[model samples]
Target chain A: MHAQDSSTGSLIAHTESPWRLFWQLLQRDRLAMAGLGILLALAVVALLGKATTEWLVIFDPTTVRLVDKFRAPLSEASALLPDADRPLTGVYLLGTDELGRDVFARMLQGSFVSMSIGFVAVGISIAVGVVLGGIAGYYGEVRIGPVTVDTLIMRFTDAMLCIPIFFLILVVVALLPASIYNIMIVIGLTRWMGISRFVRAEFLSLREQDFVLAARALGLPAYRIIFWHMMPNAMAPVLVTATIGVATAILTESALSFLGFGVQPPFATWGNILADGKNFIFDAPWLFFIPGFAIFVIVLAFNLLGEGMREALNPKLQRR
Target chain B: MSTAALLEVRDLAKHFALRRGLLGRPSGWIKAVDGVSFHVREGETLALVGESGCGKTTTGRAVLRLIEPSSGSVTFDGQELLKLNAGDLQRMRRDIQIVFQDPYSSLNPRMTVGNIVGEALRVHGIARGAELNERVAHILERVGLSPDFRHRYAHEFSGGQRQRVGIARALAMAPRFIVCDEAVSALDVSIQAQVINLLKDLQDEYRLAYLFITHDLNVVRHIAQRVAVMYLGRIVETAGTDELFDNPRHPYTRALLAANPLPDPSSPRPRALRGDVPSPLTPPPGCAFHPRCAEALAHCDRQTPTWIQIARRHGVACHLHQNTSRQGDDEIPDG
Candidate 1:
């Protein structure tokens, strides 16, 4: 009755689909807007940084300059000494790293790695999680032979969760050849438990609702019922989880790379850049500060975005 | 009523298994619908009336196989419904549909009104494209909704409008029989009349048969051609609407009639039945109604009553009705 009265009073139900309503709600929240703006800007920068590596930076990120090493930003390194080798690169924007690689260029290039790892890893996690979690959740109590599907999947998920995620990633990465794909897979494989549990909880309740019974009465096949009717209804929580999971995945990739087991050196991941900066923290703090700050901003943006999405998509929150 | 029954149910029972304790073993069963038998003739409305847990809703569902009946047979148009395979049953669903109890939860929230109504047509491959849209719009109008409302979601509609939409969805299937499961219970009194009139009009026009399930006896007096009163999952009495209203035979049926509120305060009023209904989990041993029956005897508590035909179209299950055959009475007219 309330939804009906309010629906006619406003154009919320008439003009907009739930998704569009969610967007409108998100747009109204300044924090969500800021989060969205940060992510968009970050995405643009990462893409532009990756695409224009040759034209924009001109200096190859991996190319080392021995004399330019440890140069403070915007300095003509040892120019007054007259015996110093002429700097090969232009003025270092954020200064050169410990290896004399252009910190700005490397950071820009590292964004590509960080962004891709975040997206691809999250995508992988979502794909695996949605399917596995969907099955686990939708068929939670259903049994196959001796094992209940929910019990089997959840038990396995619990076992996976028991292993500290980072340690699990380390063990897997240690076994497999360290590569971008490997890190993505390991992160994806280790991160689906929460999503599975969320989807299962949603399914447990949703499957009992009258609409689901109505769907069945309409004689819709089980697959269509689960995917079309139930999945969309269950997706609000999953979307929130995925949004937050993206940040977690990115952090994991960063940690893995910083520990020398992630995307190999010379690829210039933000993690390895931070790793490269760790040793030179006192001597050249810019190396540590630049990449460290980027990670902080990106992670914070995703978290805020996740929080906003949760509120916007939530009917209870958005109804007012 | 037509001689050809569109739907016939015989001893259809549904007992939901209840699990208890940690291991979740089957502890007991909820006898929601037990030995319910009835028929909905072509173009006839059979109202199955009962209290909340008496299983009128369950009977409606079992007839459609929405919830599979535990035991018994349902024959629709001479076809054994329970014996049909999945594909056959699905195809059979076209002939029989249900308008659910809650208008809010009946329609899928995510779907447009058009999709909700047109889905039956689309799924059955009965109509498509502009024809689908036209049929949906026409049915919408038939239910007193604007054709333009098809683009809107169910949440956009009032309870009355939503119930209309629910009716329209069932109507779209062009079904011969529909189980109106408390279809108008959630609406306002004024809206209830409008929906009832619409249902009446639709029935007259399309010759649609409806099994109107409800707890409202007053509504049954207006809509039902025949009434079946249920108590603890059993049909205690069934008769032509006028006969059941004027000369109710079963004690449970009398109790239900007594419970109906009379607007005229000056008339003598019968006291309502006392005590909450015994739980369906463990109904009283003999006749389920004996515990609450005012006319109960020692034999009523010891022996289950047989369903006896008291009149041409009236059936009553009670110990009082059983003695008449012994008296060699041709016409009791007991009331």
Candidate 2:
């Protein structure tokens, strides 16, 4: 009996860590695994692109060479290349654009830009969402002066939601100088309402949970109770929202750049690359197709990963 | 028991206001805990026994000010708790801690057991670093858990072990009073015995006063020095545990005691109390339990019963006991 009990105990200990359990659950989903694999590859590509462009200077995406223009995929760059440029130049793997820029080099840089924008925008949104939502849910019906914090914050969120977000982004980006930072900040600020609403809903229920009550009973200060105790428990939905939000932010940046408002020229972005290639759709299908396919795969991968996380985190759907 | 009470709650009430419509206008109040008055002396256990929705948990929370009381007073060691400022109240919480009902949800799942137990010590600025770890291990040992168990998370432990972790958390505060709010209600019957004994032993060691809130009559008889029986939102009777068990006063108290199942199959089951507990949102007039009280008087439907002392440390709130009162009647005022 003791031996059996010990074995069961060990089994339980093995699966006890929540993150391990979540990973185990996530590994069971094939689509999520595929998405994860794709994301990992993209991340490596983005990192290498960043290193080469910023520090290594191995790939220059902006060098104009009219001779290399409209080179088909898998074809070598002009054979008349000088020895100095020989080491740096390569075959147009995904073909060249109208500006004679190597599409491959531009794409590598674009990957980094897109990935950073996705992460930074979502980071800003998550920060704003968690704080506002926590305050709204924890201090529900608490009046600061004229109105309850819940009502005031929720009403403002609702007002923000009513605005067509893309158009709002368009208008804001139009007024401001087209800097990458401004686009990230604008998208982050505009897109936080959904995340805040999710966090508020989670907190509304979690605030009534016994652990929260126990925390309060222990005399934890309000901030400690909210951030330290409650926030960790309320983070599952927030994480799923964030995972999907990254996809949306990437899409938004891409759309903005496609419309000539994204990260300006000299800085390669998937959206601007696609925009630059739209004019040559018939002559050089690789330019438009490559960037478009990359965007499609990335957004789809994020969505899949987010869905997997949601299913894994849900207690009711747990297999064990 | 000592004459000086360590924790005293007087006319404590917690009325949740029901709001409706978009504008959120106050519709009415659900008086979950209305006019509850009780006290626990040093090293004594005052078990607040009641049915599920009788406001026993509410009363316990109000005493600790976990759920802020809508009205009334909670005094701990001569200090008015309800009147203390946020900072002072937080400081005062060092002497008052609580053990929640559901062991599963009581401990923070994301925190390791050591962090959970040592949190109070850190929060109160009582200990830090090595001292905090030592204290947490000691407290866990005191609660009958292996000191090494502190390294694990709450989910890794069984229900009984998790409960010990919860106790260790409360014990870490070195609290004078701890509200065990149905602390053992969710554990198995065998585990319940072990936890109750641990609580008793801890009380002896620390001179801790407990407002043990539960509906388990058998458990109450085993641990509580005093028992307060509640029906709906009010305490119907309060007496010495043995006295209340041997000779229960008030129809609600009698019904509750009679409802406890016996060990022998041959023993006939007492008639169960009829109807559900009246909704606290719209409680029946006069006695809250009148609709279900078998021996309810005609006046019980029209006039609220006054709490009267029938014997020393024994009080009953029923019109039947009103005439036999030895002291002046203490009418429980509505909140």
TM-score of each: 0.92, 0.94
Chain A superposition TM-score, candidate 2: 0.94
Q: Candidate 1 residues B1-335, lDDT tens each? A: 66877888888899998974345567899999988888888999999998998998888888888788999889999999999999998888878888887888787778898998898688778899999999998998788877778888777677888888888888887888889999889888878888888899989999999999999988999899999889999888888999999998888888888888888898778787989999999989889988888999888877888777777788877888786743322221111
State the lDDT at A214 in candidate 2: 81
DockQ of 1: 0.37
Mark the regions of model 1 whose C-alpha exceeds 4 Å error after superposition: A1-14, A54-59, A76-89, A140-142, B20-25, B267-270, B325-335
Candidate 2 at residue A269, lDDT?
Answer: 96
What RMSD, rounded to one decimal, does every model reach? 3.9, 3.0
Q: Write the per-residue lDDT of candidate 1 for residues A132-198, one digit (tens) a residue.
A: 8788877776777666788788888889889888887888899999988888888887788888788
Q: Which candidate wins on DockQ?
A: 2
Best candidate (score: lDDT): 2
lDDT of 2 by residue, B1-335 (tens): 57788887888899998875455667888999988888788999988999898899888888888788999888899999999999899889889999988998888888889889898779778899999889888887778776677777788777887888888888888898999999999988878888888899898999899999998999998999888888878888988888898888789888887889878888888879898887899899987878888888889988998888888778888888878778744742111
Pairs with steric clashes in candidate 2: none
